[model samples]
Every structure is written in C-alpha cells, then in structure tokens.
Target: MTHPIDSTEFASLLCSRLCHDLLSPVGALNNGLELMADETDPDMRQRCLDLLADSARTSANKLKFFRLAFGSAGGFGDAVPTHEARVAIEGMFAQTGRVKVGWMVGDDMLNKLAVKVLLNLSLIAGDALVRGGQLDVGAEKRPGVTEIVVRAEGPKLVLDPELRAALAGALPPEGLASRTAAAWMVRSLVTGRGGEIVLSAPGEPMLLFGASIPG
Candidate 1:
C-alpha cells in the first residue's frame, strides 16, 4: 500500500501539472502580443498574428483536454462518449504534428472514472515519445471488466523510473512530483477501485500500458 496524499497537497500538485503544461503556449501568446504591439512591418506583423493564433489554439486544446480528463466535463453523466475523448486527445497532439494518434476504442461510452484513467494514461504514454511517434489508444468493455491499452512506438522512447515507480505505487506519496502527478492519479484511481495497471519496461523502443478495471 502507498501512503495516502493529503487532499490539499494533491490539489496543489495537480495545479502544478496544469500550469507546467500551459506555461509554454501561454507564454508564447504573451510574447506574440508584445511583438505585435511594436512591429511596424506588415509582413512581420502578420507573422506575429500567426504566432498568436497558434498559441491561442494550443492553449484552447490543452484546456479542453484537461477539462474532460481532470475537471467536470459531460456534466451529470455516469458515462462519457468515447468519441469526445478521442477528439480531445487528437486535438492535444495535433498542435505538435509530430505525434500521430491512432484511436481504436471500440466502445461508444466509458464510465467517467474509466475515461479519466484512459486520458491520463494516454497523456503519459504520449509524452514518452520524445521524438514524436505513433500513439495507439484502445479500450474494450467485457461482461464484467473493461480493459484499456496505450502503446507508443518511436525511434526513441523513455519512461522515467520515477514515473514508473509512482504508477506502481512504489514511490512514497511525499516523493511524488508535478511531472509524475498524472501517472500517480492513474495508479490511485485504478487501484482504489480494485483495478490493476501494467507498464512496459523502461528504455524499451516501444512503451505499452495496460489497465484493467472491474465493472
């Protein structure tokens, strides 16, 4: 068993995760605005406009994805459409263009908690593809169980040992960092509900995640 995280501390950690992901694009937006204000050349001004637009889109995409993955999305529903999740995931990777997403979820709907687990795991798997590779996410519902798999194949893949430890509940709660918060959340949510999460060995060319949850 892992040490339980304090509610206040966990919330702070999650906030850190959100800010870290948003910082780059959000900062870009600010910088673009500053450039636009001083630029006199028409062509350079247009370039600034392009930068602003791209930053805005990136910010929006991240927010939308986080809304569903971490916040209250599909309000009041016990299940959320799998399609929505796919769109959210696609939009997030769309910004980079290097990472390609292959969604293979056969189920039309997933329970709220299952969807959260899928998205969080997908985020971690997607991040492992540092060189930007293929991400395949799939989930299936059986009579009494639901299984989810996230696989990443790339020229170079790295799953940090700290993240693996957090996902396995081998890291003490005090050791959890903002970078590994999502993995910790996945482990906590799945194991708290009596589910199990499997991870491929670190440094492998391909990274795979398997999660099983009882219905």
Candidate 2:
C-alpha cells in the first residue's frame, strides 16, 4: 500500500509546477521588454514580438488545461464530468514546444489521484519529445482500479536518469527538483492510492508508461 503525503510535500510540488509553467512566458516578456527598450531593429523587434506572443499563448493554454488536470475538476469528493476532462486535455495541447499532442483516452470522470497520475505521466511524455514528435494519452478503468497511460513516439525518446530515480521512489533532492515537479505530485497521488507507475524504454523509439490507481 502507498503512504499518504503531508501538506508540505504537496504544497512544494504544486508550487514547482506553477513556477515551471510560468517561467517561459515570464522570461519571454522580460526579454521582449528589454529588446523593445534598446537596440530596436524593425526585423529584430518583430521577432521579439513574435517570441512574446508564442510564449504567452503557450503559458495561457497550459494554465487553462492545468486548472482541470491539477485542480478539482475530478475527485473533489464528487464525480468529474467527462467533457470537462476532455476539454482539459484539448486545452493543454493548443501549442506544442516542438511536438504534437494526440488524444486517445476514452472520456471519463477520473478520481483526483487518477487525474494526477495522467497529468504527471503526460508531463514526463511532453519532456521526452523535446525534439518534436507525437504524444498519446489514453486510460482504462477496471473494477477496483484505473490505469492511465501516456506514450511519446518520435524518432527519439529521452528519459532523464533523475526521472527514473524519482519514479523508483529514491529521488535525490537536487535531481528531483530539476525534474518537472508534477512528476512528484503524480508519484504522491498514485502511491497514496496504493498504485504504481511503470515507464517503458523507447523501443523502436517510443516512450510508453502508465500508472495504476486502486479503485
């Protein structure tokens, strides 16, 4: 059985996810302001403006989706709406860093921990496709348990060692912090539900993994 998480751990991981998502936009805004302030070239300024727009769009879209994924859309002591969950996934993928997002999960109202598992698994998959590729999100529910799977298929699949460690539950603080904090949240939520996660190798260049939560 998995142990429960304390408020401190929960708060720390949640804060990390928010900060990580905001950094790109906030950084872009700062850079755009600076560029506009001095050394303004028509072409260069346009590029800066474009960068700002891209960053803002990415940040906004991600936040909108995260509100459902990370928020109480599901498992807030009440059943979550299937359409809302679908909308959450759709909202999250409005823009891709370099890769595309694919949806394959059947619509369902996931419990809170199950939602976190999917969210964390997606976070890991998103990072793996840094060079641009496709991501697949799917889930399955059986009596007494639910399984959420996230797969990243591209020409290449990269798995950070620290991520492997964190998934194994022996994470080092420094290395753990460097990873998307959502990873930890996923871990916490899954384990709290007496569940486990499995990450497979990129055979033929595909990263696939899933988390199972007790029903």
Candidate 3:
C-alpha cells in the first residue's frame, strides 16, 4: 500500500514535475534569443525569431495546462465548463505535433475534482505516445457515478511500470518521482473520493486509462 505523503513533500514533487516539463521549451527560448542576438544573417535571424515564437507559445501552453491541472483554477466555482477542460488539453498538446486529440466529452460541466482527474489522466496518456499518436478522452456523468476514459494510440506507446504502480496506488510515497507524480496525484484524487483508476499494460498497442468517481 502507498503511504500518505506530507503536504510539503507532495507540493515539492509537483513543483519538480512542472519544472521538468517547462525546461525544454524555456531552454529553447533562451537559446533562440541568444542566437538571434549573435546572428547577422537576415535569414538566420528570422529563423531564430520563429524558434523563439514557437518556444514562447509552447511555454504559455504548458502554463495554461498546468494551471488547470495542478493549480487553483475554476476558483470557488463548483462546476467548470467542459469546453474549458477541452481547450486546456488541446493547448497542452498543441506543440507536440506528433499527437492528435479526439475530445469526446460533451458540453456539460464537470466538478473541479473531476476536471483535475481528467486533465491529469490525459497528460499521462499523451506522454505515453512516444512517437506521436491519437489520444481520445471521454467522460460521462450518470446518477451516482462519473466515468472518465483516456485512450492513446501511436507507433510506439510506452506506459512506464513505475507510473502504473503509482496510478494503482501501489507505489510507496518515498518512491514517487517527477515522472510519476501526475499518476500519483490522479490516483490520490480519485481514490480519496471513493473512486477507482485503471490503466492498460505497457505492451499493449494502445494505452487506456479509466476512472470512476462518485457523482
């Protein structure tokens, strides 16, 4: 069984995860700026400018996604519009040209916790698509339960075993790392609220994630 983590440690893990995700684009932005400053050729300068723009956009997209997924988005509102979650997911993967998303969730709203679970699961699914692929997300609310599913298909899909353990609430708190933090967070949120999470194994051609929570 996974042991409970103190708030400070959990927050640190999340910070590490965010930093790791943003490092690449932010580093590229710095490199682009440096190149633009040194290059005298007009074409090379223009290329640097373009790279900077892409990096800026990527950085912005990641912040937006993380704000909703890991921050206090939706504020005091009890329910967040479904479109907002959809847009957040789309923006998160926008820079990853290798991945495509099929959003099957409807226009109805979702509670804050539900949205959190959805986005975190989507993040894991998208990351599993190592060679770029399609990710489909769907959620439905019926009476006492809410159902969420994320499916990923690509040329080379991998679901890390440690991540699987984290998602299953089998990974000890001490074993948590930046790579598996999101999965751990998702599992904590779902099961904390009397919900259950599931994932497809690594060897499968596609990665599938499912969660059921009390409505």
Candidate 4:
C-alpha cells in the first residue's frame, strides 16, 4: 500500500536534506577561512584563497539548485524559464567535476511545476552516478502534458533501494528519511498532478527516470 506523508513532515525531511548537502562545502569554507587566518606562507595563503573561492562557488551553486528544487523560487509566475532549470542542473554537477550534463530541453519555458519535477529527477539521476558519468536531461511539452526524462550513464551507478522505492511511491511512511526525501518529492509532485513517474529496470546498464504530468 502507498503511504501518505503530511506536509509538515515532508517539509522537515526536505530541510534536513538541504542541510546535509550544504554541510560539506560550507564546512570547507569555514576551514579555508581558518587556514587563511593562521597561514603565513604566501603560497599556502594562495592555496587557502583558492579553496575558499571553490567552496563558496559550490555552496552558491547548491543553494541555487535547492532554491528552485525545494523552495519558493522563480518568483510568483506560474511559468519559469527552462534555461534557469538547465543552468541549475549544470551547476549542481559541475562541483563534482565527474559528471557531464547534456541538456536536450527544447522548450523555452515550462510551468513551474514541470521545472521542479525536472530538476528534482535530474538531481536524483545524477547522484546515482557514483563513479561519475554522463547525465542527459530532456523535457518537452505536449498538447496537454509535460514530459521530463533524465538519463544517467556511468562506469558505476548505484541507486539505493530506498530511493527506488521512494520514487516508485512504494516506501512506507515510516521508512521515509532525509536521504530519500528528494525521490519522494519527485513522486509526490508527479502523482499529485495526475501524472506518473517511470523508473528503468533494476539491472539496466544506465538509469533512466521519466515523468509525465498532465496540465
């Protein structure tokens, strides 16, 4: 049976997920600052500066992606520029330097709901590429529906069972956790809008996620 998650609990899970992701880069920024304050060697100081810059960029990129994926971004408009979503996805994977993103979205703009679904699924699929890989994101609008697809191909891909269950909306409510929050959110968003999410078979060489939402 499918379990339902209340809004309050779901919000808390999302917040936990955001904090967990930000912790590493934000901690690096702090460490870099501390090192800069104590380091007297010119070269060491330059290295610290570089680390600080990289960390700051990573933090900013994560925030931008999270803002769109989990927060109230893109203003009050019902539609958001597809370019923003593409940029957000690119920024999200750029920090790892392991994954390459191919954006095949032809639509100039998509409804805000579609953008959210697109980014969230892309995030999940990209993360599954544990050993780094190619992530291709595509989206298109039909007469009465929006379709989004994310494909991940890598040397080593690992999609956790809990996440898979969450995406399929089969996880029990008590089984939900921060790690599976994004997957749950994707399922919720698509299904709530009278849509469906599809996952590639477990033994597939590559991971594919597709969502179709009716307007």
86-179, model 2: which lDDT tens digit per residue? 5555556525556676776675666666665776677777777767688888887789988788888777678786676567665645444635
lDDT of each: 0.90, 0.69, 0.89, 0.91
Best by lDDT: 4
List candidate 3 stretches off by more than 4 Å: none
Sort the candidates on lDDT, descending order: 4, 1, 3, 2
Q: TM-score of predicted model 4? A: 0.97
lDDT of 3 by residue, 1-215 (tens): 35688888888989999999999999999999989888999999999999999899889889988998999888898888888889889888745678899989974899989999999999988888888899999999889989999999989988888999999888998898888888898998898888899887668878899999996
Which tens-of-lDDT digit does each residue in 1-215 have in candidate 4?
34687989988998999999999999999999999999999999999999999999999999999989988788998998988888899999955789999999998999998999999989999989999999999999999999999999999999999999999988988899999988888888888888999999998999999999999
Q: Candidates' TM-scores?
A: 0.97, 0.77, 0.95, 0.97
Off by over 4 Å in 2: 1-10, 33-50, 73-77, 82-94, 172-175, 178-180, 202-204
In candidate 2, which residue pairs get closer than 3 Å at backbone N, Cα or C atoms, i.e. clash?
Answer: none
Give the distance in Å from residue 133's predicted Cα in candidate 1 to where it truly belongs.
0.6
Span of ten consecutive residues with least summed lDDT in model 2:
172-181
lDDT measured at residue 123 in model 1 versus the true structure, 0 to 100: 91
| TM-score of candidate 2 against the unseen true structure | 0.77
